[model samples]
Target chain A: MSSGDHTAHVHRDDYGSRMGMWLFLFTELILFGGLFLIYAVYRFMYPTEFHVAAMELDTVFGAVNTIILLTSSLTIAMSITALQRNRKTLSLVLQFATILLAISFMVNKYFEWGAKFGYGLYPGSEMLLDKPSGEILFFGLYYTMTGLHGLHVLIGIVFIGIIMYQVWIGRVHSTNYVRLESAGLYWHLVDIIWIFLFPLFYLII
Target chain B: MANGTLYMPETEPNYLDYRGRFKGILGWILSTDHKRIGLLYLYSMGLFLTVGIFFGFMMRLELIAPGKVIIEPQTYNSFFTLHGIIMIFLFIIPGLPAVFGNFFLPILIGAKDVAFPRINLLSWWLFAIGGGLAITSVFLPGGPADTGWTFYVPYSIRSTTNVLPAAFAAFILGFSSILTGINFVTTIHRLRAPGMDWFKMPLFIWSLYATAWIQVLATPIIGITLLLVAVERLFGIGLFDPALGGDPVLFQHLFWIYSHPAVYIMILPAMGVISEIIPVFARRTIFGYSFIAFSSLAIAFFGSLVWAHHMFTAGMSDTGRFVFSLLTFLVAIPSAIKVFNWIATLYKGSIQLAPPMLYALGFIFLFSIGGLTGLMQGALSINIHIHDTSFIVGHFHYVMFGGTGFGIFAALHYWLPKMYGRMYNEKRAKVGFWVLITGFNLLYFPMLVMGWLGMPRRYYDYLPEFHVYHFISTIGSWILITGLLIMAVNLILGVRRGAKATDNPWGGETLEWRIQTPPTHENFHEIPVITGGPYEYKINENGQEEKKYEEVT
Candidate 1:
């Protein structure tokens, strides 16, 4: 919807929007929560292999992506604050910056996955099949969890991109910025999940 | 009525009418009105029920005389698989919450509509798309999924059938469920009328609240599990594939983690419907109001912990088995609390033997049998004997079909008039109830016995020793289907041609009764300030409290 396309009816409230967003974030956490559960179970089953496989993950790339995600999380939170204070240009710029960081994180993820594929560590690969089952599981979880995390980064970018436009058009301004805040919370959630992911996959070694 | 008094006899633009901005079907299909959305769910559920039951009928027909009477084993496998998928995902899981919860939750809690109406509409659209995808899978080259609705790994991974579409369809349906949950929870928390406290809210809303939490929290696990299954099938992702270092049994762990809470999802709301009906007919305040209310939350909480009971025979540890078994039996307490309260509410009270009340009583009876048999199955030693047998199947049907199915019927009879503004033939409704119950018991009870005697489920062919139970069960299916048909015809005719009903026909104390019989498009003319609890049945003729003094004593 356009900036001026705000409907006249239906009373809107910030608290309800925030509560709805919080509840939704719970679902998203639990969405990744399931993956983490699987990860925990497998790690418990195969710690040595998981640790060995963790050494194979490119730490520099993961560390860089983690920095990008955390920074992006900061920018989005600042963006919401800026919007709340009616700093329109600043809010839009911060949001755009957040989007760029999300893209950078994904770019790093792509290279990491490509490097793994180059090494023939992809799921169901002959090389992977020859590895110990624990190593197979560690790499499997790495690719799947990070791949799913990458998907979230992609979704979060699109989400922020929309709000960036909304903020520009004044549809998501000081008076009506819950949309922006909600998107920010989602971005932070994506970042938080990556924070856990980065340590699990890259630092666990 | 809002206060057990005011109602609109004069006509207005009811939600059922094509009086909205969009003309005709678009008015409903495109509408964001909770009532319209509820109807959309109701209509779609009816369609799926028919499709599910027809498959069920075919399965029964094939099982009538034992060895592949009318269909091959493969066909039978696909039939039961498709039936379970459609019935569980499309019908039962979404049955009460999507339909009745949508229609009445807003009204009962004295809100104009749910917290997020647009999201509510979106939920239905997703439901439609998910349903379409499922139906489309049936005609695909490999035919419908034969891996069963559970989509247990290894077989699910190895099956040549269209697993991805079916699994993804369920995944998509789970989103609709999660969204509905979000809306209901937000609405309950944020949208209640000024004076309507949580306890003052009707038991249906309480049940919906409990159901919504499970839907929101538990559904995502299944969503991720299903997606992982799809991903595994699509790309040989070693997540659940044992050949790829993935454990297959872990799949069961994740599946039932959601699926078991899903049973509470199916039954809790049904129990809530019975709770609403019992006190209304009995003309007394609900016995143990907060007890019934908290017990709903209790069931939802305890229900999630008992998922491993499903895996006891799947090679669990003795400690794991012992723990899950204890939790499973413990979870039965809330349900028992509800049952006792319902009976106590009915005792010595001025009970109206209405069709709704009959179905309510029937629900208790059938659901009790279902619950008791479930206890039998839950016992660690006993479950090993009947793990994959017809006894488990019988217990499942009694709870789901007999309990939730009859629960839906009771709800339909009780509120259809408020929905359509017309009354059905009570005598005919009762006849449908009777035949359905009789056919139900005859159909399922024997399976329980046969299960104990070692009749394995999901088999197209049975040994001649099991032939007698199969025959009787098939006959029961016939009677059940006939009863269902009669009930369907009766309700359909009532909606079309029956006499118009007055608002507050039941003289119940819910807010929906305060408005038009068929509520207006906006639902409330003015948002009602709740004055009292939902089931305060007033005294009649002699100004007595309508106490069945002796019965309570």
Candidate 2:
């Protein structure tokens, strides 16, 4: 019922904004769902090869990254709570903590992927091309799925960094924190995707 | 306007004339107003439509005599491929919803604008960039994609043409569709007028509600799948390339998964437009309002299950084909319900054969032909027989072009006055309708016959036995383009200088007609409170139906 002006007086609907974020998150899930379907089909087709390839993935690295993502999700959630309590400094600290965890997760992924690349085990690599077709496909899905998931982690870090600044400026605070809350929702989605990716790629065997 | 300050007019101005921070072209493009955004889609779609039709016309001319009249076979391949890409992605997919839905969804529901105005503006920008990339692929080094719009893998991965840009364009467009869907769903859920409830909302809103859900849920699948094609191409990933231990059939499954429901995304909004038009012109309250509303949901829900029907001829298990065939038939029930309701609404009413009503009736006839032919293809045996034939092409054109395209034309005729505050010439509009419908059937009907006679589609040249059909279809293309040109010119002239129109030119009983012509910057001066159905036309003591305005603003 407000005027359709862009900036004179903002029309804020917290519930509507949250609902839109959830709907967007659903689309993100479906986006990853396509890749998951591919993973399932390939896994079913080349069971032995997938098992052999899963054995190649370092479980310790996957487990550590999983813990990192889960903790980042918690810190983002707590940041929302801190903002709700009007503790701006605490909220910013928590957001920065989440961003640090996200960066650490990406760093661990870098060393893991770097180890695989050192073995020439990437899509279209000469060493991979010499392997069995099923094994090649296993590495292909590995890179595509985990690689896409890594991109999401990087995006989450950038998003939280922006929201952290917004909170510092008092634009998003106790009374109006949907912006921070939406960033948390996106960050959680990134974490949940990694949770599924962890078992499917690293622990399936 | 001062820097960093919006220029809010002292008195409310029509959205078309509203001055904002930006001026001229910048104003139209940068403005977050829903009305201006709708016009932006309309104008961009107009440009794409002309280019797409030209491609179709050239393909038709090349087929007129047989062995390559105008271009080489490779060029012909790019022509149909580009034609399908432009028409499907740029024209029909966003056709009705982007143009009419953006303009009217908020107004029809008695709201100021969509839930997220900036996101809505972003959707249009994505559409433009996606479309630009697609057309720009034509002049790129490798030329436009010849993998067809579906971009079926193996060949798609191996093709030397610019499949990358085209595939990326569709992926970008999918994002735009998803954003629009999110915006509409949020707006409808949160921004309805004070008293308008679920059932009392306009049937068009119901159709959009269904269509928006499909857009949100279905488009992301295509987004990822197309990206997979790009990945497979760039990295030689073994996703769909058979040489790399990939199954090509999987690509078909994933492609149609989104695309099959995408048909609903295109038509459901068109159905909404028809629902709005039929009752207004027939001068009666819509019969079976809930049925029409629910049928839209039914179509959206059932449409997703029937993607395998497209894969039947592509080779799947018998049980899989059987299940998908059955689901395909189930989806038709809702469409039939809508067709029957439109017919019943026409019966025993003061029917005016206005230009919009004419297009509505045309949609019923043409879409029935299209839908019935679809069922014909849904049969396992019949589908294999006509799977890649010209019959499939005919069936698609009948539905996408005849049904949804006509529905868009009807919307233009019905709502353009409200949009531009001017009226198009009625006699010329009726003439345009007749010519277009006549040319339309002439262009497509022969494809059904030729296809039944075993003429395959996507062939550069056909046998001499198919010559007559191709000739007639080509002639029909000429007439159809002429009809299109006539209508385009008439509408353009009308927008420029037609007579000023009254607010409620068609006596529409919806919330839109209750407002000012070419509505103000905020659609309603005061947000309305609705107390009755969208098409509540009461009968007077003189035994004629009269609309009673029960809505309070």
Candidate 3:
């Protein structure tokens, strides 16, 4: 009870906050789940087209971005640990590191999307790619999924920036770490989503 | 103290003091106080309800003639769409929970405030903003969305109306619902008094708990689905447009995913109200308390999976239809359990025919018919006969309006004295109830017959053979509207000059009734540690019911 209250007074009930965040994550999973179900049905119907389209994605770029996201997840986890131990400076540093890695992931994605756009692979673009019928379907899902993921990453960066400011101002301390934990949890989720995206769009044979 | 009336001098800043009346008004409008925020929701929602009822009246008037008499076809289409959107999103979903649940949940659970007061206020503001956007869309150049509230895809995408703004408004409203759910979940879990265990909490809190779960879990799907619709309209995204190789059925899947659980989100709190009213008026413990609580949860859980039943006639596969029909039938079992428990609770108890109790009885009888008719729709064979007819509309009205709407009125009447510190005229209340009930049946009952006779819904005109039923329904609508107006006036008068109410007006054992009417800012002067279950009806040595509270100090 003491530990619960101690955690609760500063963090305002981690059990509730954590449960709420998990519920949110569940909703996120279901949102993407709808898209995933669509991807499954479409891929099953047009296996050959999906494979040809998957081959167009740069695996090297996808693997590098995956590593970047995975490392950012580590940095975020370490930052949570730092905040819990009252190491404000160390936590701030780690958060910056995580943010930098996230930026690197986005930068790599930018060039890859640029290359696709240059090849006329963009949806509704004048650059007509091979196999018009199924290629449009492939690219449609591609842009929607990655574009939505990019938007999430942007939101995650903003969340981390807010936490960084709170730490800098000394508003967050060892007693108050729930926000940090929740932010870290969100950052890791963004990374995990990218992990699946890599395999589905880049690594699949 | 013994009489439970603690009056301070009128000279001082009493509980009713509007001293910072200007600031108080602004404070209520803008401040993050949960109570004030709750009242803000009440006023805003009431405004929307008035607008929605006017639209409904127009719809009824338009139906009075077989052809377009009152309004043109396009205007009629938009009118009914606006009516559906406002009544469902603005009134019914947030009706009881936002106004009543926000005001009373904390007090009933012995807490000073909801866990996240600022977020609570944010939810109300979001609702206001969303509602404003919806209303603004009505004046758009293309006119308001006539795609119906469901906004089924192929037609929705092809329609040249203001689908983007209307759908975006719905999307924004979903966030308000989600935030409120998060706030309530945290408050109920963290802020209960020392001895108020999960099972020991009032049934209202229990209903809210179930409702919050649905809001949290289900609202986001609609949020994203509506956003997809907006995106589709804006960029011609092929998510639901079949001409662009997108599947329209996917839209149905996503829409129903949220809209189905949304029905539970609307009704579960009302069920909580019925549970509270029954035990109090019947002078007994609620029969099968755990069963009732679990049934609310069961309804929430099963409600999500049965949404595909709405898509049966929309060209789903034979397998998909069969599975959804089976799941739909499964969902009814939990609702049946609740009805059975309500009946069992009334068994072997002294039943008082209070206004609230009468509404509860009305709810049971009507919801039973609603639920049973729903099972008929669940049958693929029967559905093909009655799909999209007035039967579907009549069935939902029985559940939503007859079940949830009547239940909300019951709760308002039951709690008004405790909330406003005044008693309404009992005689007038009974009269209003009977008129509303009779009119409600008269209005909707004919629709069931007309539907069976194959009268389609959402049409501006119908055949002459359907005229008698439509005429009856129109008259019934007039009667229903008048009854509602009378009830509203009665409550207003009651608030002004009625008798000052005692705390335990219904003689219930809930913690909310233990406090003075219009409770203090902190709710409890001192927090109570619960000593017994919520529906404790046992008599003490004097052969009278024991008072639950020991002492204030």
Candidate 1 segments whose C-alpha is farther than 4 A from its true place:
A1-9, B4-12, B539-553
lDDT of 3 at A174: 80
Give TM-score, chain B, model 3.
0.94
Q: Record all residue pairs in model 2 with backbone atoms less than 3 Å apart, i.e. clashing.
A: none
Residue B334 CA error for candidate 1 (Å)?
Answer: 1.0
lDDT of each: 0.88, 0.89, 0.82
What TM-scores do the predictions have?
0.97, 0.97, 0.93
Candidate that beats the other on DockQ, 1 or 3, i.e. the better one: 1
Better of 2 and 3 by TM-score: 2
- Model 1 per-residue lDDT at A2: 10
lDDT of 2 at A123: 85
Candidate 2 stretches with Cα past 4 Å from truth are: A1-9, B1-11, B539-553
DockQ for every model comes to 0.54, 0.59, 0.30
TM-score of 1: 0.97
TM-score of 2: 0.97
DockQ of 3: 0.30
lDDT of 1 at B221: 96
Which tens-of-lDDT digit does each residue in B1-553 have in candidate 2? 0011122334667888878778899888887888999999999999999999989999999999978699998898999999999999999999988999999999888888899999999999999999999999999998889988889988899899999999999999999999999999999999998888899889999999999999999899999999999998887877878887888998898999999999999899999999999988888889889999999999999998999888887779888998999999999999999999988998887888888899899999999999999989988889888989999999999999999999999999999988988888878988988899899999999999999889999999999999999999999998888888888888988888888876777877788877767788777766777778888765322555333222322
